[model samples]
Target: MSRRILRGFSRDEFVSCRERAGFPSRADLARAADISVGAVYAWETGSATPQVDTLLKVAAVMGVSISDLVVVAENDRHLGDLRVFAGLTQPQLAKAVGMSTTALGALERAEVARLRPDVAAKLAEALDRTVGEIEAAYERTRKRPPGVAS
Candidate 1:
């Protein structure tokens, strides 16, 4: 059987999602997303990206549409706005969602590659957000240039 590799979320999109969720510190988001701190740092810094499954899990946790979290374009600016509206720190958010600071950090950085469905659901509840909202955010941010995938 041939295994196919799935694409991950972009750094900007990851940061945007976190910001939208109220600027939760990397640790807090990682805990909420049930990922590693390294992963979150990687995602936020644009050093790496999360797998599709992981993105979905993150979206659920942030209570936004997956699309909102995945889409990465120069035009998209609502992510930053969302962060201010939510007004949350990474560590605080992670604690609320029952995750370690390290784990939350990974989520913020987009280091996580995948996540279980249950974890995603828990994150959503903790953040007082919805899966659909997360998914939508992902979609909005995923819009690439006419000729580029990234």
Candidate 2:
């Protein structure tokens, strides 16, 4: 049977939080939440949206509320939210992604800077997001209003 794709919390957002939270694998998440690995993968990939009970379990593991996990709109992109939902301190995420906490802070705060390709890849892997997602986030940072402090 084909899986349904729902329009709620973005799969990318879910994946990013899972990675940042240091979930070793989908199986690990499944074990933690008492769900199937396939279900976890499907949820992370947008193939399937979890039911309320499962969503609650996932939120509990990720340290976020159901509202925080839902991505109702395109502009709902917030890396900080993902970081916080993952229950990771900036330093922890920075160390995982092989970047200095200062640089990570700049990225989080939208202090735009050209990222090295390798670093970008590392960030993508560590965040469980595509490189394009990271690039886009940084690009948005660059286009922020001039009066805004990065």
Candidate 3:
């Protein structure tokens, strides 16, 4: 069987998440994710993307989700704004979702490339809002026309 290599990672999302999380450097994030510094660099540069398992680990360590690291849509809520409205800080809200402060910050800023449904559940629970509300916030931020694929 021939294995095809594909590269479609979101560099901005990776960097934004790392920087927001205060990893200090790419090496620090790599160490935390138990991956090589080169791998981190590769993802950030869009040279390569991690497989699902690795991506999950990366998300766990970064306190984000696969969607946050890879998905791209225009209409997203300032996750931080929701937290603020609910009277919480990044660390506080992150704890509610078992995520990192940086991850929360990235979500709030919409710096993440995508927002997955599962992650939305966590955010919804943490923010004391319904999942539909959260979804609506993201939906409002989308730049798509009706029924268009984002």
Candidate 4:
């Protein structure tokens, strides 16, 4: 049998989470992720999807598993949410995980296809979360179902 593609979250959920967390603007997320405010809008409005590398960086900042941002069944994922939960600035998270801000941004944006094992391990340690959690969250986002695609 073929595995069904799971859907993710909706844009409203992303916005709601941010608002509830007291981060009411894309600029806030941009600052945290070290990305342009336009990029934050794109991610929030479904204009663009972040690269995997960028996704991880965002996750680190938000203090969540990449899966937490994913709206499974809706196909919507919010790396920004993860970043907010992690509560780390891009530079701080990058330093903790032993990567340059540029490299971290690449990961958060999913521009890089895969993370080096060592780096991933270090990220897991610094985030005070397990490597398995990070990997599992990444795995859940492999397929984009309808309604959640960016």
Candidate 5:
């Protein structure tokens, strides 16, 4: 799949965001995120990747949107990126939108270029994003150039 395995996580941005959020050190940030210092170190050094739920908590503790800690601009983020940032698994988001997991996965992978407006609406509501944002993200994912990260 062409999906971005790391979802654009930026170690520098994460460290900067933590500092900006008033966490002076990795230990402080780790305490706030309820994770270990080693985990924070791993993230900072790009040696580990955060799961969706863990990233969500870190984002919350840092007082920054997930996009702020990622290389991708918020508007440039694709369907899967948005979904992952929103901490929803394909199965969970699929059930919430009344679609099969396989279908949702296809959409997330940008294999399905067009999504129904009703399904988009459901996604918007479920992901706590605007419908316009949903549609734009879908378009970006579908039209992303070959070998380009989404």
Candidate 6:
């Protein structure tokens, strides 16, 4: 599938944050982030979005939260957005929370009518959201049209 930047990941914000964090160059940020400079360039240029793992490292090095790197409104966030905010790949998160990637994807796409309470608890813990927030996001996802994103 295509690698679209999760909604709310601002390249300009990333650049500004990097600068504010005192990294004078992408190479410097890369070194601090323990990733390739090319990756930084790619993300900045919108040629590619950074992986969750890479973004996680970069966020740590820059002393910013993942949400700082990718800004989403609290109420607007959905399951997919929660995953991204946690800096986890779908597979990674699925594995952590003991769900199939397909199932997670389905939830993200609002393929189901409602989230199971147990599943919601798992997702909440994994994504660092409250159960109510998870349910609310799921509701938002359900209300949104398919092919849309948060």
Better of 4 and 6 by lDDT: 6
Between candidates 1 and 6, name the one with more favorable lDDT.
Answer: 6
Per-residue C-alpha lDDT of model 3 across residues 31-146, encoded as one tens digit per residue: 99899999988877777766545666777788876567655342443344355445454566779898877776566545577778898999898888888877776555353355
Candidate whose TM-score is highest: 6
Q: Residue by residue across 28-80, what tens digits does model 4's lDDT show? A: 87788797888668778887665545655765566655566655432233332
State residue 142's C-alpha deviation in candidate 6, in Å: 1.9
Off by over 4 Å in 1: 1-8, 72-150
Clashes counted in candidate 2 amount to 1
**TM-score for each of the candidates:** 0.43, 0.47, 0.44, 0.43, 0.76, 0.87
lDDT of 2 by residue, 65-141 (tens): 76666654335444443454344556777899877888787776666557667876887787677788776656655
Provide backbone clash counts, one per model: 60, 1, 6, 34, 0, 0
lDDT (10s digit) by residue, model 6, range 1-150: 433356777898899999999998999999887899998999899887786777888999999988877878887887788888878888888898898888888888888877999999999998888999899989987887756774
TM-score for model 5?
A: 0.76
lDDT of 1 by residue, 24-143 (tens): 699988898898888889878877766555656777788876556554343342222122224344455568768876675554433455444565565556555565544343344344
**lDDT for each residue of candidate 5 in 51-100, tens digit (9 for 90 to 100):** 66677788999888877776677778898887887776677788999998
Write down the RMSD of all candidates, one decimal each: 13.8, 12.9, 11.7, 10.0, 3.2, 2.1
Model 3 misplaced regions, further than 4 Å: 1-8, 72-150
Candidate 6 Cα lDDT to native: 0.84
* TM-score rank order: 6, 5, 2, 3, 4, 1
lDDT of 1 at 75: 39
